[model samples]
Target: MANVRQASWDGSPVYELENGTFLASLIPEIGSNAYRLRDKIAGRDVLRTPERPEELRASPGHYGVPLLLPPSRIRGASFPFNGRTYRFEPNTPDGHYIHGFVRMRPWRVVDTSADGDTASVTTEFRTADFPELAPQYPHDLTIRARTELNGASFVQTFSFRNGSDEPAPFGFGLHTWFLLDGEPERWTLKLPVSDIWELNEKLLATGSRLPLGRYEALNEGMNLEGQNMDMAFRIGDRPVEAVLSKPGYAIRYSANEPVTQWVVYTKGEARDTICIEPLTWTPDAPNLDAGPELTGMRAIAPGEELIVRTTLSIERE
Candidate 1:
């Protein structure tokens, strides 16, 4: 049987789930991020973590899984939803709200328990509680996340509820970074997507879609050696699946229907880590009134909730 326990990591309380063969670490205070996951028997890290505590404290987005609300970028830090306008502080140098406000906020632990071979922890965050976020988002919403480790696989489920009287637009995603055990050049990736979103110089979606001809590598796993990429693609309403394989290990990821978009990032000097994000909507979704269907944004009525789930399984060859 696996045990789920809480401990301290870099001055923050962390939850650890282990079954001798697998280990998983979750930092609830910091965006309820799962900072570490490994196959203890194979001595392989499934997720990337900051090398130093200062690095993590300095930039939390560089590692692990950080939840993204209203996902991706929003043009000029403001967007009109229904009849009201929602504004956000510019978190990116390009003057846009990059990844929403919940990623750096603390989440309340609702429960932690182990059932036979599975260990799980549930956390929740209320949007109305954050004074700094109220002025920007100004919506009454709640997000609940539950992470479960069953044997060697990890799964995360997220639920968003609209508590306000009026309907609210919703988008969500998880920015997950996977660590490569060997050279990045030797790694291969396969993504199931038909169209790619066109982006401006600032990385904001331009309301245009292009065929995946140029990205044919997505169909047939392509080597990622010298390739530089920071792109998002449309996954339609079908189930989404992605695979990343190295010499000795492979990671298979899947997301539910709500996840209609996929974002991939692997550029710059740091090539040891790759980010494969599953998003509920495209970037600048709220502003994409011309083609709202492409945005995949949903409007949840008061007291209504939307749930999304994702799973990651690691296999050794």
Candidate 2:
């Protein structure tokens, strides 16, 4: 039998399988953290935090691997889909409410690798969590996260299934955050986009386009020290590139299609991190369409499945 070693990153037991893959780290505990893979020789801070749940996040600075919609934050009703939306039981008490689900429930480790480099964890959520909108929005779904470490990069493949008679309505993405040395404003960004879209204060899509202004590189990667940013951009069909440079370290990122929009978030201090999330669609894919925000949403046809694949590569300069 293969040795299955179980440990804790926060309070959650981290399951490691026969290989190097790390299967799952349950959140709000040790599991909330993201997988750590570093070029130890370079003296970089890839292991962002030593704490539990917060530490598992992409970086001590950014909100790492947020599951989105199903747990952490729930977006209220709109068009693409309809029905009463459920609150996350006040998951976080830090003022404003979060979007639909990311880190509210306990996830299970379905499988693992011995060396702790790869594994798959499965999590489920009910429309019930959204109590007020429950009856109207009845459906069941499964969100599985498959994480694997290949060389220097970490690849997470998300598979969501509409497991019931009705088409389960929801949105999903892996929130991968990175540590930034300076204020995000000082850095100039380079991507394949020709324009940008402005959002409402509610953080919903406004359908308006803003000129990217400047060159392929915008207010990104410039090395601003005291400024902070939380902006999203519209990109072309090609892969997007994000380059960040400081006096001591420089990093670059490249990802294939479907991750066209990059949600860049940062804080002035508190660890200096940036969140460059790779999403298959926009912040609200189902909402962009007609009817309830869940409208225009794709259904898995009971036994059918939605397979989303994305890869991220990072290197130091």
Candidate 3:
């Protein structure tokens, strides 16, 4: 049977979930980030975590499966939706709001249960509960996150609901830092990509796309020997699957429909951590001079809800 417990990580509150094959940690106090996931049978950590919990709080997105509300960068820290402009404070030196601030905000753990072969925890964040957010993003929004451990697989589901009468723009992303053991050269990565979003010098999409011919090797598995990537790819109109393989095992990440893009980043030879982010839309979607169909831009109408699920499973290779 699987089990869950309220624990502490370096004096911070953490919910620990353990099954027969894996051990996971969820921090509700800091973005409900699943900061640590370890595969017991393979004896390896699947996600890269900081040495101390404080380090993770200092830089949330770089560590665990941090949720990006609008994902990646936004040009000039603002965008247009329904003839109204929504704005955010720019946090990057380049004058872009890189990855929305939801990941750094606190979430409330609403439930935790262990039944049969699964153990899970559910956390929630509501904009209505935070009065300060109205001045910036006045929409009434509720985000519920549920993390589950079922056997050898780890699953995450995020449900977003717009409580406002007006339509609300929506784009969700997870900046997941997948770890690579042994030599980085021995690792392999495969993405189900179609086209690459062309970006300006500031790393925001430029309303143009490049053929995947230049990155054809990624469709078929490619080695990480000297690969340096900080690019986003438009996913085809189907389910998405991406795999990162190491010597003894492989980790597969998959998502269902409504997820149309992925961003991959790595430090090449300097580090063993790689981030293959799943996003609902390309960065700067609203700012792009294109239709929502091409940009993957989306809006949740009044009383509407959007749900996206992503799963990470360990497989022996």
Q: CA lDDT of 216 in candidate 1?
A: 72
Model 1: colliding residue pairs: 185-225
What are the per-residue Cα lDDT tens digits for candidate 2 across 1-317? 22345676545555443323222233423233444434444655432334455444433223445655431122343333335442333323443334444354445555555343333333344444444535444555665666555444455666766666765655444555566543445444444555665667766555565676643455343444443556556665444666555544555565554345666565444246766655444554454532321121344556567665555444545
1 versus 2: better TM-score goes to: 1
- In order, the Cα lDDT scores of the candidates are 0.84, 0.48, 0.88
Tens digits of per-residue lDDT for model 3 on 178-241? 9876467879898878888998888899999999885888888889877778998998763499
Task: Extract clashing residue pairs from model 3.
Answer: none
Candidate 1 lDDT, 197-251, residue by residue in tens = 9999999998888888868778788888776788889987545989998788778
Model 2, residue 221: what's the lDDT? 34
Candidate 1 residue 272 Cα shift, in angstroms, is 0.4
- Full candidate order by TM-score, most accurate first: 3, 1, 2
TM-score of 1: 0.95
